[model samples]
Target: MAGVPEGPEAEMLAPNLAYQEGFGRVFLVCAAGRTGERMRDAPRERLGDTPEQERGIVRDEPGETNRIRPARLAAVEED
Candidate 1:
């Protein structure tokens, strides 16, 4: 193809679509929707994690609160 990036076609996802890429393949992921925040963080009116054991970093916290769960890093197939 002309002027297209010379590599595998990288997929651009729609909003709220869960996915991860490793090596050359991408996998779609969905949370169990359990007793905690979303894969990223709580609602703006988030749950007071101080009131519970947090699954990962709370972005609302003071630091790199980019919390990631097992589903966020599952089955990391290396190149």
Candidate 2:
């Protein structure tokens, strides 16, 4: 899950859906704010940069490579 908001809605819905689908792990990639703050409840290992950032490629394990290209953030301003 990416950019999912941090609140009761995400807290309640995400785990339930993951459980129903029998997902062993649920990876949430949210911004560094409320979501990051709330994630303390779970055991987490944080990365320095987000996956889409230019320096976000991680090769921790010998054969495991997580390569993600940089992506632009899309937003709309209220007029």
Candidate 3:
């Protein structure tokens, strides 16, 4: 849901577009209880991350995602 501003929604997505350009990919994070400012600043904070540091971040995200997926699938299946 984040990337370069394009299509008819470019104006609305300007911030995310900037984020994508700053980072190698879209800014992905949990926003459940976060403010807009926090979300906007999170990726920027990591702008100076080294390749190894970013690799560590990248490696962790998928594990977190994988951990969530099955539980979510079970919850939906129960419903």
Candidate 4:
């Protein structure tokens, strides 16, 4: 089960629930505010990267575009 408790209520109370057999992952998606800033890095490994990551940059970026290019395409010469 996915438990999502936000703000102070979740921060103060969520830990008390404890992670044993029954409790699944407690995913807290809080507002990106002061409270969220304080909670940052509480579980770095578990949270992965911030939500800002991979948000705006399009897949068609010139730099990133060629990285995925197929090498076999160049081998096919046109008539």
TM-scores of all models?
A: 0.15, 0.22, 0.54, 0.21
- Judged by whole-model lDDT over C-alpha atoms, candidate 3 comes out at 0.67
C-alpha RMSD of each candidate structure in angstroms: 13.8, 14.0, 5.6, 15.5
lDDT of 4 by residue, 1-79 (tens): 3677677656645443442112244433322233553554343322343334323222224344454344435655441
Segments in model 2 whose C-alpha atoms lie over 4 Å from true places: 1-6, 23-79
Which candidate gets the maximum TM-score versus the true structure? 3
Residue-pair clash count for candidate 1? 0
Off by over 4 Å in 4: 1-47, 56-67, 76-79
Residue 71's lDDT in candidate 3: 86
Candidate 1 vs 2: which has more TM-score: 2
Against the reference, the lDDT scores of all candidates come to 0.31, 0.39, 0.67, 0.40
In model 2, residue pairs whose N, Cα or C atoms come closer than 3 Å (at least 3 residues apart or on different chains), thus clashing, are: none
Candidate 1 clashes between residue pairs 3 or more apart in a chain or in different chains = none
C-alpha positional error of residue 4 in candidate 1 after TM-score superposition, expressed in Å: 18
Please, what's the RMSD in Å of model 3? 5.6
